[model samples]
Target: MGTLVTGYVVLTAYLVEPDGPWDQQAVTNSKVAGAIGLVFSALMALLTMAFVRAGWLRKWWHAIPAALAITALLRLTLLAAEL
Candidate 1:
């Protein structure tokens, strides 16, 4: 889930709106959305693995939905901030 969402964001950022962080960005120096999304996904994968190894989760796959929710929350936050 996280991979899918982040992939979309990165694709959009790279192809649709290279100059913006989000779909509606005017302009900013923040890292490109694609890079940010990739970084977030990578970090989440590591964290998920850590959790799974710690006996906190049965499968790393289970982290996808949880990460999706968090990504959604961040998306909403960016949208609201844009407004």
Candidate 2:
């Protein structure tokens, strides 16, 4: 999941700038968005693994929905920017 999200961000960023930096502003925005997605996904994966190992399955299960919501929100934000 983390990899998929990050890959999408990277791919989008590259596509958004196929030939060098189209504009500093666009590149900056893409980098920021990619960083946010990368950080959130990495943190969620780490927390999930830790929760599972610590026998917090119930809580982790509850958190999954929120994590997914954020993921969707992020995707929407990225797509919206492209448009």
Candidate 3:
């Protein structure tokens, strides 16, 4: 889920850049955002797995909302920036 969110955000940011602004800062921002998301997702996934193994969070459903929200926000933010 986190991987999906990070990929969506990174891909959208890349696609939009070619269609519009070609600024270095925009590229840097995208890279930074993607990197941060990747790191966060890695951490969260690890923690979630650990929790599940410990008999705490037993379902993947717990992470669904956050993943969906991140994906939606990534798309919206890209559209807004393009606009």
Candidate 4:
């Protein structure tokens, strides 16, 4: 969840490029890195969630943070895209 949250924030920020905007190459590089981070984070999140559900883990509270992370990700992505 932490990874996801961080990934999402970082990815969104890269896309948003609020720091005086961004060049095409810079945006492309950032997107590549961000995509990798988001993919890994998503995989970890799903695995951990599955473990928790299957009684292999005991951290239910983590789900709350994951949910928040997803919400923030969605909001930031939407805002960045101006949609």
Which model scores highest in TM-score?
3
Off by over 4 Å in 3: 1-22, 61-83
Residue by residue across 62-82, what tens digits does model 3's lDDT show? 474357446545644654344
* TM-score of each model, paired residue for residue: 0.41, 0.40, 0.49, 0.46
Each model's lDDT comes to: 0.53, 0.56, 0.56, 0.55
Q: Write the per-residue lDDT of candidate 4 for residues 1-83, one digit (tens) a residue.
A: 55655556555545644333445655455555455555555666777788789888889746754654564455445533321
Q: Write down the lDDT that model 1 would get.
A: 0.53
Task: Candidate 1: give the clashing pairs.
Answer: none
Pairwise lDDT winner, candidates 2 and 4: 2
Please give, for residues 1-83, the per-residue lDDT of candidate 1 as tens digits: 55676656644543432233454543221235645665757766777778789998779565674565455345434632231
What TM-score does model 4 achieve against the real structure?
A: 0.46
Residue pair clashes in candidate 2: none
Q: What is the lDDT of residue 60 in candidate 4?
A: 74
Compared with the true structure, the alpha-carbon lDDT of candidate 4 equals 0.55
Q: Candidate 2's residue-wise lDDT over 1-83, tens digit each?
A: 65456556545644554234345666566656655665665666677777778897655453553555465455445543341
